[model samples]
Target chain A: MDRVRVVGRRILCGILLSAWVLLPASGWGAPLAPLPAPKAQKPAQAELGRRLFFDPRMSGDGGISCATCHMPAKGWGDGQALSAGYPGSKYFRNAQTLLNAAYNKRVFWDGRLSGADLPTLVRDHLTEAHFMLVDGRLFPERLKQVPAYVKMFKEAYGGEPSFGGSLKAISAFLHTIASRNVPFDKFLKGDKKAISAEAQKGLALFRGKAGCAACHNGALLSDGGFHALGVPENEQIFQDPLRHITFRRFNKVIGVPNFMNLRADPGLYVVTKEEGDRGKFRTPTLREVAKTAPYMHNGALATLEDVVAFYDKGGGSGPNKSPRLKPLGLSADERNALVAFLKSLSGEAVSAKEPKIPDYEIRKLGDN
Target chain B: MDRVRVVGRRILCGILLSAWVLLPASGWGAPLAPLPAPKAQKPAQAELGRRLFFDPRMSGDGGISCATCHMPAKGWGDGQALSAGYPGSKYFRNAQTLLNAAYNKRVFWDGRLSGADLPTLVRDHLTEAHFMLVDGRLFPERLKQVPAYVKMFKEAYGGEPSFGGSLKAISAFLHTIASRNVPFDKFLKGDKKAISAEAQKGLALFRGKAGCAACHNGALLSDGGFHALGVPENEQIFQDPLRHITFRRFNKVIGVPNFMNLRADPGLYVVTKEEGDRGKFRTPTLREVAKTAPYMHNGALATLEDVVAFYDKGGGSGPNKSPRLKPLGLSADERNALVAFLKSLSGEAVSAKEPKIPDYEIRKLGDN
Candidate 1:
């Protein structure tokens, strides 16, 4: 029985390999380049940032952390259509993957912030009411009370615990989160058999007929530019009253004219306040795309196939839809190949040892 | 400057150690025995259970898992006063630590079930609407749909996915969660310096004047019996209307007479429907007790110090208050020693590698 099973497995493998090789290889383009190694960060600074990132005490309710949404096990993005916010809230947009985020010139879906420095982003996220909801002034004092945090701050920054030092340390840690040397990278580095033949065909389609490289270009596979792709509205948002209120108030505060009139997300228009920027979202990198699902800004597309089909139809109709989006007349095989290529982009799984949080002992006044 | 810093650190360490040793050893008693290792489990069965434990797809929403609330990192509890239920829901009760739970004859604070076998507990937790909210019948079908799970199920149980098989596999995994060899255990095993002298004084008080051994006895430091300790009501439950409704309905369904009139938690009363059983909760094991806070069924106590103080006051006045309750007259030093001893119950940390969840591809009709 064992011999028969082994023979059967070999036959199956042979059939699958032959089928891949038999596919027409026309329209193949030059292989994409590998991602470059990120600059090394100080070990002490990165270590401190890691602990801070996982510490829920930094949040208002002390129940959420940076790792909650950007969990390393889930491709640095919680595999959800929308990120769960503080106990009573939900994010208006899908949680973006943190992989290769350092390569982006701007952060977040709407490209509201121009600087991608870790410290600036950490500070923004820490104090953002929509995120951690921690008061910046009080947060430092809270950390100062914990002896372990105080020690870490002094070691990482050569000073007492402060908001600026915390952000800088956390940023340094974020810089160390770069993923490199994926199978796609090996294929790009002249290893013809690094990825499956199906992936090779998909790579060809991505760069050529599919026109993915028009926006998804460069080592990170994103131009870091915003464009209106006319992605459809996620009706799920209407069911959540808190999310609806937050979305409306956010757009209004950002000076989005006629924000109430918008049937769907105004996207970049909320940041830029330009009518042409309406519904435009920053292009996302495709690194580790296979692990992150429920795609798009609102997570409207459930799968890569759905996303490809949407693009194949030149996206949904909108006033500011990018002209670059046109019907991609790709065959079924080509579409599957494209997905296979994208799957190859996944690198080695990243995991971090959870840091030991210090226990705070309640001391009587003047005891210490 | 460096030499001065080193001298200051040594002085601080000396002061802390000397303070511990200076505590009176008058109440010191015989040390407790170390906890024994759990029986070996079949590797294949446990491996299958580990995978299922971490697979969020097992839940109704395909989001929550056993590990969601019983996170290994936080001592098999989420380190919350109340466990977060399905995305929008909050549990009325705190998540219990699974460490050394196998030693119990009854499960849960209410002691609703007498059986301690893993499968029974797994089934109860899985179908509990306030917990995973997963329908047993549908859950098996969900697992069956996943090819990888089906293969694992077959290997582990020699059958396709079934409700019984899934429960057994998950139970097998739970059996592997036993924690032993804590510092207290090492001290009990004749390692005099395994725990601090303060902890030694605390252990003596626990076994003698503190009267903790009356309930918290045996290898697991729990008598596997119910006791009404008059734990305070968690007001947080009142803030959640759903929790209030669920609590009422659960008590009513269990035939609790005048459940509404009961102050705080009815606890074991709901299960027995005996008026005398009112407010009685099963004694929880002290294994990894330091990691699992706020203490008690309602999670009203915020710290171990608060828990010790509560006991020192001989518990609150209530109908079913244990007759064993009496003021221990423990001094400040004794209280600190007891807290230190409790902290020493924390064993080596346990962590499970996250299993890779297989993606479910939407196939055309009859494609499989």
Candidate 2:
């Protein structure tokens, strides 16, 4: 209770405060893990899938290919606020990049589909009127007409050009896509100075004060869980009749209740049909965050800075907003550092060349 | 001026009237001509065309073949008041029978396409969103993939599965679809008992008082000219949202003025772009009329009696109604005779069996 005892207690408190404020968090290891090395794929099937990926013949109008929405140049995304759908349609959500798609088995913003059953996922996109609109019974007939396709299908599946085989081929090619030579990987492998000093500082903030690692953690930089971040609706889904019609139809197909009055995208509610799941979306991976511009499920954030600012402001307001999302009171320098750290996760932009689509030939009957 | 002179004049007029009323008009033709013999087609080419006609792969979704609407069982017409269009769409007009389509050079109710240019006509029906909605660029790719189609195309056109060649092959087969063993044709060929006495009387009325020969004449039983008979609109066009949307899109595509406000079909005006041409549809051939029930461009007249009643009532009310349309003052017996005569124009329903659709065969890139 003496004056000397009080002075000693105050000094000890000051030391602890200075350490917390000035000292940096280690960026080396712990909660956030680096992505694993790319897995090998069968050459023939992947090659067949590569051909199908670029061929617009996969679509209803044969005017759009998979590359139409998932272009490699724009980090595998279309670089738009909303996706371009079938010729007469408009998509409600932003197209997710395929750069590290294989690493994340839970696909799509709402996670209505799983990548584990990639054929079904591909089939869904192919058959849906809003996408390719392919007729399953007729597509095989189409494949039979192209000799080159037939040859490839035989090699890939050891059988004819069946619908399931074609889908599997496309899926095989998708498996080949992965992040390449990321600096963060090298840093995780004990390479000092692989990331800039400022980026290191950002990494510290991401782990500690920003609290981003809570959801955006692990090798894929995602917990693979659904959460409601209270992201604002893009409004385009309702304003555009084409998009609105597709949205309404999608809801009806998924058996949502009272879809006629349901305005905003029901998100995970479409799959679960639960009131509590409303507006919840899968936590997206942050591996190639730098290259994919206009972030979030609806592309509401146009820049990395905007995304960082969103989290800094405690996210948007909604009754079901994730309690994990809270205000991150950080200095402007710390925010810049965090954005820099995200850029280090992406390496060289991944891409593949389009294969030659074979022409149809007619020979005199029995002559060949 | 004497009473006897006036009585003599009346007697002379009575003799003339009696001559017109009692004697039958010769069934031997002048305005009406027998259909020429069915044209001979190269067996290979016709066979190929037959296969194409039955192949649903001709459609976008591969669910609708050309024969889907033009079934042989229904005398080449779908037997629907309004046509079933693409999966999500509904057609505003009735499906015309293709029984004697070869003779009818001006195809379609609007006569926008000429059968003489069968390739273009087929293309219109195949590519129109309200019809098959085939992607032209994608279609040839589809054809080339089918090995059977390839050989057939080669035998038919001496070339690969080119678009023009396939269309030409189809046209060749159509040229062979002439009406067979029609009673009217036998009657024209000098068989006195070929037609019933009532039908002969109906023929006289058709040429004389009914005045049908003015527009419905010649070998094909049509003048190949446009006329407005004021056929009533089918309420289904407006009652169903799918049909309404397709109708609106069609009007907009045809460049109709104030299309948003244009509710009724503009008919031949779509081709002419003239206000006076509005509501004017082609005089459809009556060769197979008995089979295609729910007659007229709109199929508003549900039966032959409904049609006879329509003409008996001087056709429906419209600004562009044809002057040729007038009340014939036909009794129920006279109407029955007319219907009987129409029945004589048709023969046994024309049909061909569906060919076996080829399946896909794949070989490893270099394996045979």
Candidate 3:
């Protein structure tokens, strides 16, 4: 009998540990996760990364810097559905934000990318990503020309003569993109009057009937898990394997073009290449999404109202739809309150005038 | 004998009281004029004025707002010798900062536009003096086409509906354009370490050897006086009046081609029309002149060094030059230190983005 009691105690401890691990990644279908408390200590790497993030020298043509796309003013994402690519090339996907991305295990809409390591991700974004081409060439060759980048990279990485210097420096910057203090955050911390009455009503609806909290729980508003939401499949997944590499893992076709001449995006089928995984996409963090307009994966919706209405209507009747998809009846006041709470997520951001680039003499490629 | 002694005692008492009355304003300058100590009372009118001051609707064209010239970001002035005139017009003088203007008895370089009130000045700027024009027409007329202005005007002023509401509303705003809390202000308030050691040294030089305090003194940094600093007299002032009128005031000539070419400026002569007034401009407040670059009335010098150098060389020696203009020999370090101290004079300013016009329908002109 004593031996049996000891075994039961051990089993209880294991279960508790497992639950804690699963909390952040998936709480039913909730996407929100509580942010870690900010450290009072100022990390030098974060400061360096912040400078690089704002500086335009990281880009090839100097016209499209990192800040141009991942703008702090517009919720770390350009307000555009897809950012205008290097110089003027059109991109296919909306610019994903970098807010609290350090907490993320997997990055991007399809979960084809994973790992919280900054350097690897920065390198992939600058080189492998199709969006950041400069002067009709890749960023690596063009970045070599800017003297400021050379100096910054050297300072950030002990003057190392490699692109790794830049990657490390930029990743150091990304760690600082933490969510600001929000009303909802305050509400959970015992301030019953923190959120407005309307928002409180909406929150109740979210946790109860709407089941939004099922997928949008925690502080960051992401479960960090994927769902097959019955979105239409794109045929482009088969034709353009390079772009569809991530979606094909779900064995789903990329979305076809809309009748209105809009590009129909394959939400996640391009990554997994599994029939069951078709239209499966990672839940997005709702923090600051109000400012990043033209919502959804393709930016098909113009307003937050449209997004809420779409979710309420149970999405498109496409194949491999999640069982979670259902109509959520909500009043107009409830919807408005939800939007109001979403808007309150944004706060005054720190801004500084663009720094003047110093004049520098660069040696020709062969001169060295 | 008793009557005589009583009379003498009364006389003595009267004399003592009279001395107390005359001592503060005259002996200590206007800063000690028995006025109430600068209180922390937040003036609602000043707040209203601040809103109007930031509003772009006051300008003729929506584009050429007050911020276009007296920029908050670039040191309370556009970083130009002279501000570009509205649409296609010539600017005759350098843009003057509004800092501490409330303390001045005289206004403009020529000291010909002095008023005890702010509304008159703002009106003059809006209607006549270098206003923003669209297709060679005043901005108020253009505003008449928009319905929004009518509502804004109504809300801002209590008067019955009209095209040009209350000019006093503008004056209320200008009254709030105080110099920022600079390091010197901190120093004056007993924080000796607020200013750097180098700046302290520069301040000593300014007060002692340079004798800058003699003219540029008191709280507002001016004695509300005018002086001829031996700048070049306009040739057209004494030569041709009509042909020079085009040069003297806003005209199409300055805007044609580049606005930076040989500008036809009349300086102080436009105001006084006296030979002695040709180079006699007002002793402007140096409150934040470090930010308002292209120093001097005509914007002849591009930097503060050029300004100090001009003063060090007794200004450009010419007719009607002030006797105060005399050469002073200083080391390069001393000059740079002076610039540093001057830059520290700039205080907190309003940001450009916060005061944008709300989307409102244009009011029809005939509605009033």
Candidate 4:
């Protein structure tokens, strides 16, 4: 009977070890996995997109570019809590990272933009009155004047410079921006030693007791769904009159159904007009979250620790707060571990050489 | 008689070539020459300085850095006609390049600060209300909080962080930033084929008919003297109330005798407080002049051609206009050649890697 009992204990121990090894590999109960490679794009098309991305002449004032806010050094998001838009304008929402954005079904914080194609989003951002402030019809003419751009467009699209061609090129470039070979990714791909033991413990907590995997799951660590996390209001917006006015105007223009609280940003409610959808923002991908600080839709939190603490405390006070969020009862060590795990998601730094802009003579109004 | 004529012609040709070479070598009629290598600095000290230079935490709001305006990508100076200062403030003068700045005895366009030692200038820039707005006393305390900075400071200065130490370190780094081995420098060093034929012609014109060498001369291509070039007033300052207010306030604080025309920026007169000095500004170094566009103290000229044209037309209309700036009567070809020569002054691009700033817990107020 003693021999049988000892044999039974040994069998159980072997089973546990096997389960630990197979868990992440099978993706049965794992919270995260390695992000899949994106669809390949033509090198020339992507190259044209890259040039257009950095060209400030794409804006009305010739001062702003796609790279102005989406800086590579700052993890494709300007390290500011709120990004500067046009000269005197400010953005209401925090600038989101372009990394692995092509994997998302929707774009923007509120998910107002639908579908994976990014040209429409690009067009909206370029022509938006408070954003780039460029006229779409006149923009093509500016590109056509640059001999280098004209040549590049011809090579990339087999056509002259046009509005559609510009959009296509930019979108193609966006699709190529994917994160890979991160520490977390290596760990997910069966390398037990890739991440620290503390991080491995954090991964377990992230999937189980912390309950973070409910919303933040899959390869991108986002469900591509909207939720009201009850992020606190940014007080600076209330203090600055210009910012307040810009915010109100933007909401009004977008036809947000509820205007009762002019100070409050009603995230996804603007698009759905559903009373239930109030304060709902899309779940942002956790990839490169360490570098893109001042977290959340309103950028109220300053660091990953603060973000983790907020979640531990079951988010801020609000009527529309997610029911899934509850006090995690996390220890300080667990909090640190979670932060470390999140930081490990940051892959190799993305950088590109600034393209040489083709010099063109400034044509005055009515000059041939 | 035929042999005598041939020998005479050879002698004259030899004499002309010898005179041409000797003229530049003797600093009699040279346009520009090679920049001397700066005294060697401790790599550790310079490395610490580099981190401090790029760290935005040096600013009050943790937003601006030395790299903000003096970007390596944009030839050290930001490619703005006038740079944006502290949030709402706009600078009256254009951002000057930091390249070979250590060689200058005077700093700033107005020459308010004198001497090559950069600590005083560093102090002024840090605490200046319209600039970084950082208090020196508080800045060192901020640096002490970061473990990496504390370690680096100790290694570099052999003591705890201090305001003086910070300044000394930054100044030490700036002293190492010297321009060298430009195309013009190579040409000056007896490489006849180093520069293009057009540039060679331009060099002759620069020393002779153009009279550029009168003010712009020496190894660094600056005589380090003030002159009244009668640069036109920038109308944009008058349009913005905050900028106009800031401009008036800065001049008043600096003790300019007359603030009669708020629009009129009385360059060096703000420092000297003399009638003769009213519109005088320190002649800027022409090294890398082609890259630092929107020329002059006020950035009135957009391109090299515009600058050449301004000189050709004998400067703008002003009471204090220098008598030295007589019309050059340069033709279009000569103007193009002059621009080409100026372009040759730009050396290989200067760049530095952004340092990894150490992360520390964000303490909310007074905390040990």
Candidate 5:
């Protein structure tokens, strides 16, 4: 039985290898290059952050960890339409992919915070009511009780366990995650046939006919700008009271007018607090597009085809929908090609194994 | 300034000594005998338990520790009428003293659990909604994250950090606590000069006129029985919505009928679930009576004088008020003597300094 299983796997691999496209090495003419490598991080700090990224104890209930949402296996995005929030609460937004996040100048769907300040982003996620719900004052003490964290903090920051130090350590670890070798990068580096012919046609449509390049044209395929794409709302927000409560609470805390009755998410308005910014969300990076699914601020589109179709039909209705969104009237073939090109942007799975969480101990008879 | 302060203190002490009572050395007539010493505990386990007792991180929010309400300086009980509960909630009952807890046959205000199995008691206090509110499933992981707790658990219970082990460790520490040297105990040991003549007169009334010994008897000055003394309700339960919610929730979860509208504590009915048990409560130990002020289940009485006066006028109205409660018709002089005798039951403060809580560390890089 084992021999048969091994032979079966080898035969499947053989077929896949033959089916795999081999690009012409000499003629390189890709439109974009790979993202610039993320800044190098301190080994000790990064190491500590890597462990903390998976540690659930930092949460209010010790049941939710950073990795619980930003899972490495699922393109650093939980494969859910909306985040399965911390215990007893529900979230209203889709989990965003964290891959190549190091290159982002701005972070979060609304771009309210700077990517350079990764610690702040981490703090927001960990302490936000619908997320980890951690109390800032009490979390450090949670770390203090664990002897292993004390030594790690001392080694990484030359200090004891501290809230700021932990965040910075996690930020340092973020620097280690970025887009790796992909066919698009290979094509940019003078390899003519890295992507298939159909993908090439789709790429042209992206730049020309579809006008996707207007906002998604950089190496990360993002302008880092907010736009009102008019993505439809996910009905689950209003249907589930837990989700509705979370939505209203977020809006209320951000001083949104009539937060109790606002049925739709304010998106970028959360930051600008301006009516013009309503429904506008940051243009997200397209890297690792294939691995992350149920895409958009509210995860309104389930597939790349659905996203293309939405744009082909001039987008959904919103208070401040962008004028740039016009009917594309693309043929069925053109639609498939666009999705194919989008898929080409993704590389192999980038992941790390979860570390062993250490147990607490009595330090000594005298020292607690 | 220092010399004058010292001289002033010495003069005050001199005046107090002359005013203090002195008893006859030969007469040895006391109503009750001294309490037996608490059972010996394993040193390593007891030491571990002692430190765990002070570690606030064991709580749900890391803001309430075992020592938070059971303060050593205040007779192992917080000097508040109602306990300052875990964050985000309010307690409805008076903080019970931990002193002589090891000697009790039953525990909790309702005597719902066995004192011999202290882990059960600790579990209730730690995880109960209005108390610590700790999630048992997550707390073990919290302990696992702390390196110090890892070692302590191993030292105490020869295992990894576990929910049951942690509770047991806290229980082990409880065993170390008990009443210490008191005047009444000294007098029972045949030292007649240990207590004052006024205290002696009060002792006679305790076993006779006042009928106090009918219930407040034995080593711990408790009958290990339940009774309905008709203690009035603490108004805070009705005044503070936070406390009221906690009360309603506690009752609701305990399967109490008509819990939401039941403004008064159900007392022993919480355990027996019988109507006859309404307003009945377990007799609390009076070993450290002097330090633990604001007495009774709801802390309706602020001083020993008030308690004496209450019993002197029979007890308050309750569904099942004890028939034993009757008017004492004692004079003001008799009230003072009774109060003095109650004071003799107390001893020097039993306390341990808070241990240095350890900081967490990053263990080996590969081991989280």
Candidate 6:
């Protein structure tokens, strides 16, 4: 049965390659993120969360916001290298797309913190410690001080022993952020004709010899762990404006330095302070990576092909790079097959609303 | 024929009285704006104008905005006792609803200016002179300094001689603010059954015994002139915070403000500055007035019935009131008929969209 399956997969790849050569270039770009099933949520909670999401007053500066980074129209990620903070800050990390963030066990790249439900994140952004932008700024504090928010938070979470109007409200909202089943998923569900034959062939390679399932797997196509794939040296291409990595030790516990390495983003290493963890970055979900271009933690690789080819060549050379970082030695056909598989990872498009702060708040923010 | 019309008008009044008794009090105090329309427009110029209208960046403090007063869902007027301005202002005059300003020949209560159009008005708001809130620290100048505005303005309006950018863009946009045809207009166009029988009778009474047609007439139900039916005397109501009206006095020979009364809004007196013009506010269009409650320039009356009753008693007693003002001695039935007719003036609702600023701008403002 396994032998037959492998043959079937190879046949599928052949059929897909022929069809892809005949297809248009536009057909190969990022597909829409799939729509997640509607969460079985209390209408009141969802409505409250929705209201809070749209309210600009929730942000620190009364201007920077979740919607600002995770624009629905722009595939839940602002199409920028790095997100801006209050007063136009060039934030260090790219705003990760928020498509299936509800599925994430650990949030942010470093994984220093976990179990940060929704409202906690929301309130923390408003607090002085987590987000410093709102500390002295007049806007976010104003929202926190508003009578309406207090009333609303009390209603949503119910003030008392266990609840404090934090993560409960936000998590209820994030619960709605599930991966939308894509054309590939549809094809996987016996709708063999939904996706082109090329995609099917790519899927075979992804599940078979390409060894992608070694890291990216499951419905989200991610294990949410870190790996150091041997791609090009980080310092070779892009100028390292903010140094994000430093090697503290060698083989014992190689960890990237937290003091801003100019080469590559130090990522999870800074948290563990382990030596072997050097250059190890979180394995981001492949769910919506097509639309989120300039891939990798530092946005080093410009295309999926670059990523796939890097893997095809078994990652860039590095002392602490994972054993899984070896090249797959793929043929052009196989490389194309891998590309097709990555393309299949794109999900259904999620609708996003543009943010609108009330005119009163707009007046208060002193912004456009 | 005239006699028959008079008899029909009386019968119409009778029917309106019955309907008024039938309709529950549920709708009495609630606003009765027009029903919404279904359509989408992608005109860049109009979109730009909309952005400017909602953006506080155009104001002195980067705060005050056209939308601050003329809210879309709330009958194009802020539903407040009086408008708020820089440093928490409490304007004496009500925020006049912009239900159908595109159809009016004159703008504002005092009718000081005309022909400048909507974009010009935005420009006037932006300028250092006149009703300039931009300099008052209401809206900062950073919004105007953005490179995108220059590009958008140039695209919307050809530069230089035409005074391109926000002004020209908004002017083009205002051209689209035409009021939708209402049921009454449909009835007027030979669809006798379009309006209820009571409304028809109410319309007749409005034209005859009620004498509302003297000021509220034509397609817009306004003559775009001023008359002082006694409104309560209040020293506080003199200043127009919206700056929708400015008292300019003109010498007939010089075509400019030659003389002006300090204590008077003087409607058209801003131009002529005649003694007779004192206290004469512009005749506002009755179209869509149902949706904009708290009638008159001060929003004193809470309902259409209150408005009819006020008219029945002529007005609150005041000096320099119009000579045409007098107690109509309207029967309860006749007053109800008048209210019905006024309700009929409500037009089809226009769609409103919340403006979206780019994420870069949102983030630049701050996290809030």
* lDDT for residue A364 in candidate 1, whole number 0-100: 21
- lDDT string for model 2 (B1-368, tens) is 55376457545644544422322233422257667555567898888888888887677666688888888888788999988887656788999988778767688899988766777877888877668876554455456556788788878878767667778777777766768888887787677799999989888778777777777876678889888888888877766755665676676667777765665788899999887888999988889788889798878988987887788778987758888787788999888888888888887767787778775332112211
* Error of model 1, residue A241, in angstroms: 0.6
lDDT of each: 0.73, 0.75, 0.55, 0.75, 0.78, 0.55
* lDDT string, candidate 3, A1-368, tens digits: 74376457645644544433223232465333335543222354555566556655454323356788777777677887555544312344567777766656678777667745767777666543244322112232223334665555555556522456556667766766676676665665556787788777776666666667677765567677777665544333323323232222112223322211223344455665556665667887787666678676655567888877777888777667777779877788877777766765654453434456543343232322
In candidate 2, how many Å is residue A71 off?
A: 18
Listed per candidate, the RMSD to the true structure in angstroms reads: 24.0, 23.3, 24.9, 22.7, 21.3, 22.8
The share of true interface contacts that also appear in candidate 6 amounts to 0.00
DockQ of each: 0.01, 0.02, 0.01, 0.01, 0.02, 0.01
Model 3: residues with Cα > 4 Å off, grouped in runs: A1-33, A38-43, A55-57, A60-62, A134-154, A230-264, A350-353, A363-368, B1-368
lDDT of 2 by residue, A90-188 (tens): 678898888778766578888988866778888988877667775554455345546788788879888867778889898888888888888886776
- Which lDDT tens digits does candidate 1 get at residues B1-368? 75376457645644544423322223322123455555456787888999999987666445689999999988898899877865423567888988766656798888877544668888877766456655454455456446787678878878877789878888778778887568876776567899999998898888778988777776667777888988878876654544553454455556777644434678887777777988899888888999899888888898999999999999987778999899888899999999998999998886788888775432122322
DockQ of 3: 0.01
Interface Cα RMSD, each model: 15.7, 21.6, 21.8, 15.3, 18.5, 16.9
Which lDDT tens digits does candidate 5 get at residues B107-132? 87888899878999999998775677
Summed backbone clashes in each candidate are 2, 9, 47, 0, 29, 66
Report the C-alpha lDDT of model 1 over A186-242, residue by residue, as the tens digit: 776667898999998888787778888777766677777889898878875654544
The DockQ-derived docking category for candidate 4 is: incorrect
Over all chains combined, what TM-score does candidate 2 have?
0.53
Error of 3 at A49 (Å): 2.6
lDDT (tens digit, per residue) of candidate 5 on A142-245: 56556898789989999877789989999888888887877776666557698888988898788778888777766678878889988888988866655665
Model 6 B-chain TM: 0.73
Q: Which regions in candidate 5 have their CA more than 4 angstroms from the true location?
A: A1-31, A365-368, B1-368
Estimate the TM-score for candidate 1.
Answer: 0.47
Give the least accurate 10-residue stretch of model 6 chain A, judged by summed lDDT: A243-252
lDDT of 6: 0.55
**What's the residue-level lDDT of A23 in candidate 4?**
36
